[model samples]
Target: MQYRMLSDQRKRWVDCLRGFCMMAILLFHTEIYYTGTSIIGYNLYVSDALYLFFMLSGYLLYKKAGMIDIKYKLKSVLRNLLWPYFIFTSVMAVPKALAHGERVDNAWALVQNVVTGQASWFIAALIVAEIFFVVALRLCRGNLFALGSVCVLSFCCSALLALNGNLVTFWQFGNALQAMLFLFLGYVFHRYEHKLVVDVWPTV
Candidate 1:
């Protein structure tokens, strides 16, 4: 009974954290849209909230990471992320194009944009990152060293891409690479949360 109460308290705190991050992101975007600059001038800090959001997502899904069926995971990703991305992108394409005074002449262009995550790039990047994380988990098979190595490699690649200004916008592969780091961090945190807390503060 005590364990159950602690679990519920943890969940409540997690939800609160998520809500705070969401509000921060919304405010950041709102300021950008209206002011053309971060009036508060804390752009980087607020932007980091998105990574935190990714971490939370990975933390929540940590239990499922142990599943052996890669195909099942991929299918879930497609159904949850890819389908919504395509449907919403398709629906909004015409209006978005018109708003920018762009001609919607090429159906292929629209299709390409959707495929490349031109509509909601976050979702697209998430799809890629989640797939990579899942595959890496399967290969690592609970080996922290292997997983850490993969995360380091991903971070380096993403940093290089950013430095070279080679980030594929809309496709957001670079963003996903960095996002993987946070996701992995979240997974590891969940896996060792109690030990970490104890190490940080011996007395709870």
Candidate 2:
């Protein structure tokens, strides 16, 4: 190990930041899912701030890959979702079948729902959202500027489409777009980490 500063401390920092982020996300999720109301407690603001810092994390972690193979990267990212998805399907199958008043004994139907991304779009959405910029970067040849442009365009498109909320493909899949926004933010942070931490406290 010739030299590496953050590498030694990376797990510590990543854990701290990730813990905070998870708390915020959990708060926002709980309030929304449990209440079905858009009411913002203190956690919503905290969640928003955590998301900003997450962008910084993305900037720091996602270094430019020199010769990334798009096919492999795509497959690799998707693979992370496979095992959990199967688990989700198996667990939820009986409950969903029972609720539907269908033959709850049909294991095949439950498996079909999970495998096809129908029952677990949220998990699928989060997985793909995290990979959006990675995939985009692969297509863009790892150009930071190009990646940032996609991020900005995604934000603009989101804002413009927020009013209608039906123009974009797959926009109906709950919070998938929000997840993609995080991925894009990661790209931005990865590109601009210096400005972020350097200006965090403003040296005296």
Candidate 3:
């Protein structure tokens, strides 16, 4: 396959999509935080939007992850998750624990909160998913396409199992699989993004 760099305009579009995704994420968090005040669709719509964001997140961060060397990419991945995790969990856990007169066990669990850090189990989920996906990628020797599809199906099945137990319904996925997907999508975009020129832009 031949490789060609993206034009200025298309890069701008990816940047715009990224910025929009960030805002959507923030809005979801904000609404979830304020959901106690009877804000309409605060929990529902915002949560749903966050799911879409997760589903598409893999499609988004692909390029940056893919273009870099694999070892470096793996390091980048760990660094991204670990540092903020350590810092935030350290910063927030003790005070909350003190307020309630009981420590939530450890800094490890606090990092798992979906609402504050990412969610109740998002960090754990992301780390698990990332590890599996990266291992698959390494074994397959860059068969990211095959490995990514498998990761998607595997995570979705886990979601199904979570549902069967009467746990959180729908929206069971997160950025782990998305990281792989977004990486592949970046490769695809870098490959065929020229096809994206269209008649008009649509708004939500």
Candidate 4:
């Protein structure tokens, strides 16, 4: 009963955190659009909120990691993420192409952007990251060291890509590589939550 209560409390806090991150992101974008600069001056801090979102997603999914079916999960990911991405990108493409037809070259180029995930890049990156997480978890088979190694490798690859001017954005895979590290870290945190001390503030 006590364990159940603790779990519930943690969930509530996690939801609050997610909401806070969402607001932060909205504010950051709004500020940039209106003023051409962040009020905080350091714009990256709000960008980190996106990483927190990735981590929170992984943390929540940790419980289901063991039960993941690769085929089913892949289908679900595609249906949920890819389908929406396509629909929205297609909707936006009509206007963009109409507005700048001369610069667009051809319809195939727009299709290529959708395929490469340059259309709505974050969703593409997330799709890849989630798939990578599922595969890594299956391969690691509950081995923390193996999982950590995979996360580290992903981070290194992402860093290298950035250093080399990001030669490939296919499916936004380079961004996904970086997201994998935060996702794994979130999963680790949740997996060991009972061993860690987390405090709730009533005043806030």
Q: Write the per-residue lDDT of candidate 3 for residues 86-193, one digit (tens) a residue.
A: 566567676656654666767665555533434324554454455555566666666666765776676576556556773332222443544444444544544454
Q: Write the per-residue lDDT of candidate 2 for residues 1-204, one digit (tens) a residue.
A: 622654545445556666776777677757766676646775547657556554544544365445456576567665766567777677878876665467866677777677666675555655555566567767777776786677667656666676676534342233444455566667665555445543243231
lDDT of 4 by residue, 1-204 (tens): 987988788878888988998898888767866786788744466767888888987886677336568898889888987889889998887565655443565889888877779887778888889999989988988788998899899989899989999745888889899999898889888888777666633444
What TM-score does model 2 achieve against the real structure? Answer: 0.62
Candidate 1 has its poorest 10 consecutive residues by lDDT at 195-204
List candidate 1 segments past 4 Å from native: 64-68, 94-110, 196-204
User: Candidate 2 lDDT (Cα, whole model)?
Assistant: 0.60
- The reply for model 3, stretches above 4 Å from the true place, is 1-11, 32-38, 42-45, 48-57, 60-68, 94-120, 166-191, 198-204
Per-residue lDDT of 106-156 in model 1, one digit per residue for the tens?
988877888878777777888888888888888898687898789879988
Instruction: Using lDDT, give the best candidate's number.
Output: 4
Q: Report lDDT per candidate.
A: 0.79, 0.60, 0.52, 0.81
TM-score for each predicted model, relative to the true structure: 0.81, 0.62, 0.59, 0.82
Query: What lDDT score goes with residue 85 in model 1?
Result: 83
Residue 10: error of model 4 in Å?
A: 2.7
Q: Which segments of model 2 are wrong by more than 4 Å?
A: 25-61, 64-67, 92-122, 167-181, 192-204
